[model samples]
Each structure stands twice: as C-alpha cells, then as structure tokens.
Target: MTRITRRLALGAAAATLAAPALRAQGTAIRIIVPFAPGGSTDAVARLVAPGLTQRLGAPVVVENRSGAAGAIGTDAVAKARPDGLTWLLTFDSHATLAALLPQLPFNPDRDLDPVMLIGGAPYVLACKPDKPFRSITDVVDAARARPDAVSFGSTGNGTIGHLTMVLLQGRTNTRITHLPYRSGGLAVNDTVAGHTDMMIGSAAVVHPHARSGTLRTFAQFGPQRLPALSDLPTVAEAGLAGLEAEAWWGVFAPHGTPQDAVSRMNAALKESLNEERVRATMQEVQQARLVASSPGELATFLAREVAKWGEVVRANNIRAD
Candidate 1:
C-alpha cells in the first residue's frame, strides 16, 4: 500500500429503495449518538431525526450515551437487536477506537452494519482569542520552547482530533500535553474558558467558535483550503507537508438487520440529507461537505478508515486514556 492509499467511499445513492418498509410506523425510533451532546455527531443526528421521523412515520429520538472514547455507546448499538428502530450516529472516533482499546467488547466491523457515510470535515487547530498566536510558526515555537508545558485539548484520547495533534507534534518534534475531554463541546468550552492553550476539533465543532472570535484559528488540517475558509492556511501551507486529517461522521445499524429495513432507512437518510436546510447547515454552519452515501459505500469507507487509522495508532504508540 503506497502510503495506505484511501479515498471517501461514495456512490450514486439510489434515491428510493426497492421497497420502503413500513415496519417503523408508530414506533419510536432511536438514533443514538455515541458522544456527549452539543458535538457534531449529536448535531447531525438531531438534524436528520425530524426528517427521518416524517419520512418513516415514526417518532425519532436522539439519545446521548457518552464515554470511553465512544466505545461504550457504540458497543450498545453493536449489541442492539437488529430491529431497525435503534441506530448509531457516530464520529471519527468510531473508526479509531478498536485500535486504541484492544479488548473492545464488540467487533466494529462485524457487529454493526453501515447505513450511510454522512460526511467529512477537516480538523481545525486554534487557540483562544487572547493567546499570542499569529501563525502556526508561533504555536510550534512555543511548543518547542517548553515541550510538554504547552497543552492542547481534544474530544478524547483516540479521537481523530487527538491523533491529529499527536501526528502534528511528531512531525514538528514537539511535545504538547494531551488534554482529552468527553466531547467536542466540552473541549471547546474549556479552551475558550482559558483552561487550555489550544484545541483541535472537527470543523463542525470549531468553525463556529472561530467565526465568533471566541477562538483564533491558525492551521486547517486539510490538503487544501475550503470555500468557506479560503482565508485560512492549510497545515501543508503552514510548511508541514502531508499533515492532513479529516474528521468524519456516519450512521450504522446493528448487524443482521433485515435488508428491507436497511434500504428503507437509507432512503429516509438520503431524503433528509437532501433537504435544503440540512444541505446549507452542513456546508455552511459545520463547514462539512456532506456525502450521503450508499450502505455498501459506507461499509467500504469504514473499512478503509479502520485500516489507515489503526496504523497511525500503532505507529504513534497511542494508548487509550
């Protein structure tokens, strides 16, 4: 594998499934986000739940079951009955958790079935507005000057944000103390409250804060600049070549779920994502490009992510906290 070649799995998602099952009618459908509320994962779940409720003729509920870098809640969905009523909406951490927790209770690949690849967004590294940072050079210099004295917060230990910062520190030969939180919102709050020197999170979590002047962004962890953030510099542009990392979100159902149920859920998801408000919110508010993908495509992408990030976890000697 040349640099573990990978790409976002996407396909011409069929707008309508062969047969839309009415199994969920009048039943309360639960969409479980395996992270704390106020984060991107929770946001995406809530955004689509209403539309899903309408489309499926069921009362959709979003639930937060946060802990253990998303493994606890994920494991819940992994072991849930394949009734199509219980689904999981997860973050980038989902792909990397198995690499961190070897004794993870559930087989991420075998226990849960992919429903959709919601989308991906670049990680944004930023500091509080009052911090002394004009560019990535200053941040790097500070970290080099005091090594682990400079601290950065992330959603959790094995989250892509945390690993991305780890990769950044390694590439720059710096040591910043890792401060992992239960969720992205908590991390952002503490960073803004002057509890941490810097923070890195998905565009969905950090973009709004940066725009509001609560935090000052320096480097975007994307290969190129996005339309919404054209003014910001890419990590590569900051002189750290090949330092790209994008946080992704997706939906999944318990393994052994009926094919008809999966197809019906997928169709509802595609329709919910196609809504104009959802499209604009995803692209503008979250700064995340949406990829409402087919189930097969999401499965392929999940496999690729597991392979790629698992290597990073081992190479970095990343242990779960």
Candidate 2:
C-alpha cells in the first residue's frame, strides 16, 4: 500500500511485460543497404551477411532500398522498431545527409545507434590520360588559371567525392565547376570520355581505368597512400597538407536497441572483417583497409566526421539545390 512498495511492483510488472517480446524475436536480424546492389555498400553488407547470420544463430538478410541519395533506405531503418533486428549498413556520407538536406525524416544521431565501422576506401584524384594535369598541384594550378573552367565530377552532391573536391578547392583557393552524377561509374566515364576535366572518386571504382591508361591518377585522398595504388601520393604529400578524405562505411541499428545486442553485432562484424575471404575481396576491390571498430568508437567517429564535413560544406557554400 505504501508509495515505495507500489513503485517497486510497477517496475517489476513492466519488466515482466517486456521480457516476452524481447525473447520472442531471438536473433533474426536484417541488414539494410541504403544504396543499390553492386556498389561498395552492398558489397560490404553481402560480404559479412553470411558470417553474421552464422554468428548470431539467425538468418541475416540484406535489403536494398536505394533512392533519394540513400535517404529512402536509411529512413526505413531509422523508423523501424528498435528491437535490434533491423540494422543499417551505410557509408560516412550518411552523416552529411543531415547537413545537405533542408529537411530530413530522421535524425541520424537521435534515431540510430552506432553498431560498428566496417572500413573505408580512399578517393583518387584522376584525370583523362591526355589531360595536361599530372598531380594535385597541377590541377590546382590549372584551376587557378582557368577559375571555374576546370570542372570536377563526383558521384553526386554531398557524396564524399564531392566534398573531397570541395575541401581541395577550399584549401588551395581555386575554383572548379562540379558535375554530379547519380553514380561513380557515370562520373568516371564522363571524365574518361573528355566530357569532364577531373574526378575524385573511390580508388576501387577508378583504379581499373587508371591502370589501363584511360585515366591518370594524380593523388589519393587519405592520410597515407593505398597499397593498391602505392605510386600515387597522398594529397598532403602532393602539396595539399590538410586535405584528406575517403569513402567509409559503417553499421548502425535503430536507437533504443539493447546495448547487449549492439555489442554482439559489433563483435560479429569484427570477426567477419578478419576472415581471409573478406580481406581478399576488399583488397581485390582496392579498398584501403578493413577497420572493425567498437560501437562507441563508431559513434565518436561519426560525430567527428559530421563536424568536419559540415565545415567543408558551409565554407564551400554547398547546397543541395
């Protein structure tokens, strides 16, 4: 009859009511890829889906809901029930969404919880083989000379590739027009066809053309050069000291999922990254490295990336329009 006793009874009843719902789901998990199939995000998700399915003792399915620059699929995951069954496999660009769009259906920081950071691929600054630019400085000098005439293409606006070029332009105080394509393939194709002056895109996506001499790689966007393209210098080494950016992916679940579930997902992903087949597949694609990080680490990393890209976006006056 006492207040304290009543409060304790209510707490116990709530726990009892919640237990069965949690127990009923067990371990069945779904991983959502925001982009279409065959891209890096899909590839990364498929690579670990089987291992996760085995480790969690449940089937893991990869669902692609590609559209609206990844907003459609990401919003689906954010609005899903926070029971840990639905997870999102996305890239670092998700953080930029909040800054890019005038309005967003979901708050990435509030509606999603970090599960793990999968890995990243460096972006390569490349040009047509016959183009006069041979290095980052060469491109900078050309842009300086031509002003907005030196055009650069990216997968799309707000993509890592777009932002990387923005950062480069900001640092070197040069101007370059932007051509945003729906995919990296399109942008790279245009650049190779001499339709665009340059392109900053994923190494894996651009490496083949560069190797074939159709495209010439001037520099890589990362703290260090990638082994697959060791001859190319890092942007810093190429004379841009602070310009480092890359396409990175991570896993996240809807907010309010149990901490234990997040931990299990992180552990499973980490194990998957260590698998020889996974490593080989990533390397074959020219992905720089597979970094399996803890959930907390991923959360911190997302926060930092958001701030970093926000500065670049604002400074460059980049708007979705």
Residue 248 of model 2, lDDT score: 85
What is the Å distance of residue 53 in model 1 from its true position?
Answer: 0.3
Decoy 1 TM-score against native: 0.92
The TM-score that candidate 2 achieves is 0.83
TM-score of each: 0.92, 0.83
Any runs in candidate 2 off by more than 4 Å, and if so which?
A: 1-29, 192-194, 208-214
In order, candidate lDDTs are: 0.87, 0.81
Model 1: weakest 10-residue lDDT segment is 6-15
Taking the tens digit of each residue's C-alpha lDDT, what string does model 2 give over 177-288?
9998765667778999999988888876788788888999988888887887888889888677877788888899999988877887887888877889888877776464
lDDT, candidate 1, 143-167, per-residue tens: 9999898899999888888888888
Model 1 global lDDT (CA atoms, 0 to 1): 0.87
What's the CA error at residue 295 for candidate 1, in Å? 1.1
Summed backbone clashes in each candidate are: 0, 0
- Determine which window of 10 residues in candidate 2 has minimal summed lDDT: 18-27
